[model samples]
Target: MTAAAPPRRTGPVRSEGVRLAILEATARQFAARGYDHLTIEGIAAEAAVGKQTIYRWWGSKSALVAECLVEGMLLPHRLAPPDTGDIRADLTAWVDAVLTLLAEPQGETLLRSIIAAAAENADIGRRIRESLAGSESIVGRLEASIGTAPNLTPGAPFEELSETLVGAIVLRALSRAPREPGDAARIVAAVLGPA
Candidate 1:
């Protein structure tokens, strides 16, 4: 019988390094080309890794982009939505936090890229929603803290209200309109209503 060839080695350290490099490359690509035009090969080239490596780690371009967005942009701002036993204060804080992020250049670029991606690609859109909107990770914590305020039920209406508020901020950013602090505060007040 012929001797079997040695199995390829994929050490954990190297695997993690490749993952990090891919994420960095994906960020740059997304920033430069937007999500619609980004390719796995391009990311691999930018990261100095093989396309197969990216495929093995992330499975698809959408997955990679989602991970990159979450890890780089969303995770850093992961506020649990201030409870403080006051719904208005907690929501106001949350809105302020989001508005502050929207004011930053990096935040603007990332949000635009995500919106564009979501518009043009259904898979990417779903992934974006799952990463940012669907998961109770951020909003759930906020809801728990609020503990059933007057209008803010833990239901569809509340979700829609939250979406509307955040979506307005994102739309303003995309439109190149100024995001005034007062405007964000107004949105919060409108949603929560008369603390």
Candidate 2:
């Protein structure tokens, strides 16, 4: 039999498995070291991939971190709200979860880092908006339960209500204000009315 010539590879083969591994690794490293301390070399070692592989996919560490956040892999806690069929209770639970996260030192750092990333990059800002609107996000979860609020104030659209709650949380976190007990319930009530 005559020896056959081997086929030449045309280009880099993008592997979903490797992509996921890199994202997961980035998330782990981000959670452990925070954004300022996370290094591409460290992530590559953790994911068993080369630095070039990461560079080929993401141009910068911020871009990689943005993808991790968009994929729900980077946050310290899940951002999705509970769906208990009661909007009041659900909103309260979601708000409480967020407040609890913000109360943590690492959680505060994570939020600030995300804010800094989004502020510095338009692409990251867009990705953040996209993530918040996706089915796995808090907005999506809140939408499912919004209609069940027994005494929702008139003209209080879910968008506005959500914005109000999230805006307050962000400001509070940024300002380092102490979150008091019943804060979640009070915030929810302010937007949704007495339950």
Candidate 3:
């Protein structure tokens, strides 16, 4: 008797439309039920996709949700900080862009939901952090810009300074007030010291 050939199992096909649908579904899920109640099945149904498809791409619920947060809430919407070899101008522009994004009506809600999800689930928190580990995040962007700027000593307190700048922006963003004209400049000066 002839031996039968094994069936070939190709990997899952990635579709941008399906991914967008999943992301949108995740956003709706967060809006409707919050992260505490989010479920793979629920998201699958909301996205009209099979559970295996999500698993094939993201592996776990937290990973999927983390991606949703990254794609929908935290990043991808962010603009690149201009690299003008001037830390003051670059940072001011960066913070101003963030302030504008956070000023949107749903922005606060999105930020709150992600934070709440992280607080509610330690696993989700870790996954989100891990997922973001590779991100050239705000701090990384600032460090890169600082590397090109003048007046910073080698290993100057870039991490702390970036944190200070970001923290100020986040705190101000939570207030939902119109951005003061001096806000960006003030934050920049605080970090890099005077234009």
For candidate 1, the lDDT comes to: 0.66
**Could you give the candidate ranking by lDDT, starting with the highest?**
2, 3, 1
| Between candidates 1 and 2, the TM-score winner | 2
**Ranking of predictions according to TM-score:** 2, 1, 3
* Deviation (Å) of 108 in candidate 3: 1.4
RMSD of each: 7.2, 7.0, 7.4
User: Which digits, one per residue and each the tens of the lDDT, describe model 3 over residues 88-108?
Assistant: 777788888878777765456
In model 3, the Cα lDDT at residue 101 comes to 72
lDDT tens readout by residue for model 2, 123-186: 8877777666655455665566645665343444655566777888888889888889999999
Each candidate structure's TM-score, on Cα atoms with residue i matched to residue i, is 0.63, 0.76, 0.60
Clashes of each: 0, 0, 0
Where is model 2 more than 4 Å wrong at Cα? Answer: 1-15, 52-59, 75-77, 150-156
lDDT of 1 by residue, 44-132 (tens): 99999988778776656766766677565433444346556665666667777767776776556566656655665677776655544
